[model samples]
Target: MSSIASQSRSGPRRGRPRDPKTRRRILAAASALLNEGGIGAVTMEAIAERAGVGKPTVYRQWPNAPAVAMAAFLESTRPLAPAARGGRVLEALRIHLRKVAETFATRAGRNTALMIAAAQNDSELAKVFRNHFIMKSREIGRTLLDRAIASRQLRSDLDIEAALDLLYAPLYFRLLIGHGPLDAHFTDAIIDAALGGLKRRRRT
Candidate 1:
């Protein structure tokens, strides 16, 4: 023949040896490990063992424990999307509050608090947490406020930034401080108080 029978594979396949299911398992394992044992416990060795993957696999995916932990944490604590129905801003706000309250009342919340404390010491972790959680919350709240404005439910002249802070800061404080339960009634009361002061009054 043409001396072309000696073709050989050059490198590893373009895809990883493991499939998506294995990757998901690794992420899930990392999340559970962090939740149960905090960031300190998310070593590559431990994550590999927990995930039933090799250490090389973990390292190949994440450069460091913080990166893996961040990914896992974000995966575990993913927030629900804001509802899309029209004319239900207040109701949506209430639902959001209740959901956040429930989150604050869970073991996952405790783990998140620990992550916050850890972030105080780790700048990278802090950046990751802010980007994944804090900024996302701000975006969601801003969208809600913008929608309300577009619908004329809120005053056209209302300062949306200030309004979002006023409406959400109290709830965040409540969540962090454990000052009170974040129930629907509490959310309704907060919405009522905020709307009374923020909404445009009708012409006489």
Candidate 2:
């Protein structure tokens, strides 16, 4: 049996061709609703009303509000911390992480925290959030790690899984726990610390 966290996207329904403009409006509306009132406010009716479309229009694209909310989060955040390619891998990753810190320090971060709390009780929401948002974001980070390792900037024997955790776990910890500030300074500290352990050691 498929786990709740492994649900896949629904197939397209037979209807009018999906319009790019309408899709954008729906996603934007959902994002706004999530930011303003958390995931509780992102119902199909609310999204349709906000997007100036019918309920069926929203339903046709997403099976439920959680799906729409996750989609909106991904759409809105994709550009904020895009994966860096080429150039010095560490420097590129540092710059990328700074962007991530800035993103986490905003209202979106609050919405994410809300989503996480909500997902604890909503299995469907948890699935989509983990598979789509969290895993996808980690995939980008993994690519950068692969590049760094290939370039020998990082220790060849590094454990990618543990290394990824070390690199990003603190940011999420701060974001979720709210104990410390999530900013460029914090990002630099994480990079410095993670790199200190990840970098290849000089042999005497």
Candidate 3:
């Protein structure tokens, strides 16, 4: 399971043991609302009614609609298959990028773009989204890069931060801008180009 799943359930909770079914219902309801009406459509009452639960029940699980929306988003983005252990790091990264591109073309991805746009004006949402979701995902990317560097598969002088940006930023830019196809071909092209710049130089 991805850390996103754990993060959604993180921090202290003050409620009875959470029922998985109830949680799924709530997330599903929240996702539906987001798809139907964007970020503004999801409300505690709306989620509860859609989930067949009371407002208090929703509150018991999440503080507000944004939190719930973020949770729903996180759930959708999870299972972003990690690089296979002991495989060539770049190969794993290639696979990972493909998954990212595929997901970015999904309804969840559309909702993510909307939430990010909405976050521009909502500081609290922006903070939580960055701290919990974006940062966590970056950490995952960072770990993979660290592995590549350690194995000497990438240049020792490689700037991990910039490398990550190179690997993923294009997909996101396309995702947000609606410019091009977010498909395997694009995934391969982007990763190949980025890796071409980052790979270790073979000595003659």
Per-candidate TM equals: 0.74, 0.82, 0.80
Model 1 per-residue lDDT at 135: 61
* Best-performing candidate as measured by TM-score: 2
* Candidate 1 clashes between residue pairs 3 or more apart in a chain or in different chains: none
Candidate 1 differs from the real structure by a C-alpha RMSD in angstroms, to one decimal, of 9.4
Better of 1 and 3 by TM-score: 3
lDDT of 2 by residue, 112-160 (tens): 6677776686776666665665666677677788888898898999898
Kindly report which residue stretches of model 2 are placed more than 4 angstroms away from their true locations once superposed.
1-11, 14-16, 79-87
Count of backbone clashes, every candidate in sequence: 0, 0, 0
Comparing 2 and 3 on TM-score, the stronger one: 2
lDDT of 2 at 175: 82
**Cα shift from native, residue 76, model 2 (Å):** 1.7
Tens-digit per-residue lDDT, 41-148, candidate 1: 878888899989898776656656656666665666666756858688756766765665566556656566566665576665566666666667667767777777
Instruction: Tell me the lDDT of model 3 at 97.
Output: 80
Q: Write out the backbone clash pairs for model 2.
A: none
- Model 3 scores a TM of 0.80
- Compared with the true structure, model 1 gives a TM-score of 0.74
